[model samples]
Target: MSDNGHQNVTMITCTAPVNIAVIKYWGKRDEELILPINSSLSVTLHQDQLKTTTTIACSKSFQEDRIWLNGKEEDIRHPRLQSCLREIRRLARKRRNSGSPTSDVTSVSHKVHICSVNNFPTAAGLASSAAGYACLVYTLSQLFGVDGELSVVARQGSGSACRSLYGGFVQWKMGERSNGTDSVAEQVAPESHWPELRVLILVVSAEQKSVGSTSGMHTSVKTSDLLTYRADAVVPSRMEEMIGAIRQRNFAAFGELTMKDSNQFHATCLDTYPPIFYLNNISHKIISLVHRYNQHYGEIRVAYTFDAGPNAVIYTLQEHLPEFLQVVCHFFPPEVNGGEFLKGHPVHSSPLSEELKRAINLEPTAKGIRYIISTKVGPGPCVVEDPDLHLLGADGLPKKNA
Candidate 1:
């Protein structure tokens, strides 16, 4: 302990990539706890393409604990965010009292200032929340000189966020307990475990989702009975198969289970009374085209999965990217006119401009999608040690472009 309240002030930053569940986590048992009805598996995307960078700094100069997301100050009073902070603080205090090894000692009573940013669009239904919460917990753990495991803190943020704590293939164990204390994520395998796997994210629409995933899951759990069967029977088997596929490097088995699980998850959503619409017409079109292409190829070359929104995540081998890109380009050509690609004429368009028509060879397709991001499996959270990269200023406020 020193003049800075307790000891030296320190900062820690971390970045984590978003993951798309090949075997989705559809329904929840406890909304507040974010405890899923069944276990789920996901493939962590490369951080260079899609990820969240979070910086957590502890200093006696800070007046109160605060957080900033994408350059905008957020209410730290939000229970979800507060719970994560409290849990990390508790762990840090325990470590400090035990005389544990720490990278940098900070004032024990210092307040934490956190700033986070996402590389991709937040509202595009691309699991931005997962990456955000994951990075927040990971960065805070390092900043507070916290010792012990990191998964527990990550779980308090979001159930899926726990999986993002690990890279490559991860599994969120739906532990058998009334309290979700044991329900955390573990790395099934690393990216190097299966070096050939690749993920191609199709940015269908950048429009904000009408319904959030938390709300949608709540609606499905209350209204849909199909969710019960899927959770009890379908997901358990799928989880087992998915884990085995990853362990043995069985792409064929992996692809089959992935597609089936995604379809079932969406099916349960549709079965919800007054069904919540996630995928639009354009999403279906992409699915149909992918199925047709795979059929023509006469082998299982690609796999597509969607989260709670219309964005499609296609998985394939690194070697097959060129062929896959060539076919995908024909269907979703670049948006040369008005940021819209002409896949076919819109079934109901106000009016098609001549300039728009010429972009896709005057094709009727209504510029079916937004854009495509080609990426693969990425690493776990990392700290940005560069001072210039800090998102918070010396005054404990959000820096520009944070």
Candidate 2:
């Protein structure tokens, strides 16, 4: 809808959360379309902790299409950005041609100004692009009055983005179609399906990763036999099993699969020619701590998974969060005291037993982790009704403070 007082300008704002893939999507079959080599499952973390907010403003008065990310002007000609813009405008045109009454006729012909910002670090394996692209596609769809199967559009922007279109457990199906029509994300379960599930994101580093996901995936697909084997033989069965575990709410099965898949994904990275390194010393230590803690309890109390960066995402049930968090504190001892060490959702913690600490026994890595983000399953993209939340002002441009 057009913002009041600026009759020629229509603005929309939306927010979307980053999703951590439990079953990773590493390689691509179609780079242009962003079709993954295998289906992957991910949990949509709560937006209160980490998310992207995007605003799209369409105005007939605007001279040309433009974009701003995190307050700075960015080239709108980037292939991925163009892909999403072209697809959304095409869908809108089709809707208008089909005589859809809901289509905004004036805005359909207008150029758009896009502004996007993330609360968390970008390009740091935190799924910032996934949330950003998903937010863009979603906000544009709403503004254009085009709907239905938007994950298809989001996928072209980023392979993992398709999964961010839905909340809770999601699966990005690596479709068999050469055209990639069937390769879209489907929600395995809604956020309500798993109430007790909790997530702790160990922010080992906020800096951009050494290797971007696109380049790394491309290199791995070309050089690693392990990647090919993983795509062909491993992922299919693993996808089905992951879906079953999520539906059944089987913590042990889910946690084990998450950890194993993460390890194997890194192994494939190692198998690549010249190799790619995502995990650092702190990441390895976090993995060890998780395994030792699980061993001490003789169960999968917590499981850790790393993306294309050093940050570790740990999954566990609500009941185990207190002791697990306490264990993390004992081991990684933050430099900042009190609430500054933790960000995002507030978590109640308990002190680890002295015996439990002794059994898990590890040297505390002071300041190894920047902070921990506490979150859990949350909803997908949502339109912000409050115009005050819009990143763009009435002038069809990013607000000064944005």
Candidate 3:
């Protein structure tokens, strides 16, 4: 939409979902290209519960490319940020040169104003960068009227951002190419492929981790032998097994692989010289709680995975949600208001059965967890047509008050 008596303000808003890797991506083969050492698979969480909403505007009136994240302006010169912007504009120029772009609403050389915000906590190992970069690239593609094979561009911003390009089950292939063009992500199944499956995010702490993922990965890659072995020997078979499990809807197989892979990934972190401890005391207890709960049922009805943070992401079917949640509430009683503790898709909370209580005989912790966010598999990035929803106003500035 063009502002009155001014150059056209071509703006677009897009939201992208966060993906939790079932088979984690820890090391990068090429840091500049953001290529993973091994392929990893992830479940794209429902955007209604967790997502990054980004608004991008292009105009000749703008002086230079700028960005605002979560209402705070960020340096536009950051390398990864520059990479995404450069790649998208490069694609736009290519389209313009080829006379293939259908929309000339915005010119290739126009400067852009990018504003992005997340519904969840940032830099807390919740994959905020994944969704943030995905939305940024996707929004830019719409603003510049360029599309096709965009996961490659998004990957340059953040390695896992490529996986966020798809819904439900997705895999980031660790391509063999040295230039890293083949290290792209693809959807293994649509969001509708897994309806019964649910994801519960246990927010242990919202504080940013002491070690960032990229830093940890570089340290682990340079120092940890276990990381190398896991990348070469462990992940290939698990990726195949994970794909088959997702296709067949085999919870038992799926849950085991998820937990095992998470464990191995963290082990590699520990093996890093000087070591990196992403999990805390509460994280360990949650892991134990999950094992005891599963042992009680004599089956893997639930699975827990941690991604470079203290938070635990639980996977279970709808049938077991109420019961498992009841168990969680019993052990880690909410210190905050019940309403405040649980967010996202509402679930029925009931008392744990006496029989189940006998099985998981652990002392209760008053507030080991801060809150719970219940979400499920959902679609990938989507454009928002509503002008009111744009994070940036027509003046090429952030609409958010923060």
Candidate 4:
């Protein structure tokens, strides 16, 4: 189409893992820059459990840049998405002008098409946006041969998503500047640093969250003055303590701080003018069960935290999984109705067939949970080297016409 040849287009695909904040980043000082009010820490989950795979391709034959999310074409006109694309393109242009060896500069300015898919359900409230934005930036940077820190690119996507660029424990530093240029994420420790830690993600319900994290945080910031106390007083001290505990492998201190921070963050959420409900009855019950189980053991064996939804994320030692699962199963068995435990069981059992009885016996009863994902701290975003995995076709466009 343009002066540059259309035959030689470079395509790159990248997969970025999702992260769950331990310290939590609740408020944003600047919406445009994605600057956080307080520094937060998170653990990047394994890609197999929750992740976003994004493919980016550029070619001179295309007319305009476009994006497709979860197989559905999205309006790329959204300001946040546009800001990310424009920033990445600026960096790419800089790299091209510098004649960097790593730059894959095409003779003509080309259009970029991005296609992203999340392995987990969109309704899961599992931080899909974090992985989506991180993967989008990572893939686009590679496609355009941009030479900049991944954290910088990641920050433009989502504040928490920036931490997804690093593996293991990541800390998002809330810089005290108006520009928000210094607010970036850095790795606190590697995944191998704490190999024995295990995470059990309990999917209580995968329904769409009524209040988005962004809107909730904005409300919390505007209404809750306690958030000020947290950002200025509580979090700073707890962050230092948690870092020390993590470094020394002090499970007791780690559990205490983790639970306290989670509670405080949620408290701030409730302190919002109209109040926000991030957790439901099931979530409270799970927390109570975990606390009771730990009290019964006379020591803290597990720690629980929640995000902006009802899902419960439990942290424990690798050796404690069996006991944890047993306790959870005891409390939450599969649902039963009309004496039919599993689905498709006959309503009337006049003769009571042996197979029906056996099936009923095998079927779990009253478990109000969807599923559980077992994972731990994992590595950061990585590029997919195989062309087969790319979401872009040979024409440098989205494979599904997304």
Backbone clash numbers for all candidates listed: 9, 0, 0, 7
For candidate 2, lDDT tens digit of each residue in 45-75? 9999889999999877788899999989999
Model 4 clashing residue pairs (backbone): 333-365, 333-366, 333-367, 334-365, 334-366, 334-367, 335-366
Tens-digit per-residue lDDT, 198-224, candidate 3: 999999999999999999999999999
Per-residue lDDT of 190-251 in model 4, one digit per residue for the tens?
88988888888878888899899889999999999999899999888888988888888877
lDDT (Cα, tens digit) per residue for candidate 1, span 19-61: 8898888777877777888899999988878889988777776
lDDT of 2 at 397: 79
* Candidate 2 displacement at residue 396 in angstroms: 1.5
In candidate 1, stretches whose alpha carbon ends up further than 4 angstroms from where it belongs are 1-9, 101-106, 337-366
Record all residue pairs in model 2 with backbone atoms less than 3 Å apart, i.e. clashing.
none
TM-score, every prediction:
0.89, 0.98, 0.97, 0.89
RMSD of 2: 1.9
Which residue segments of model 4 deviate by more than 4 Å?
1-6, 335-365, 400-402
lDDT values, one for every candidate? 0.78, 0.91, 0.91, 0.79
TM-score of 1: 0.89
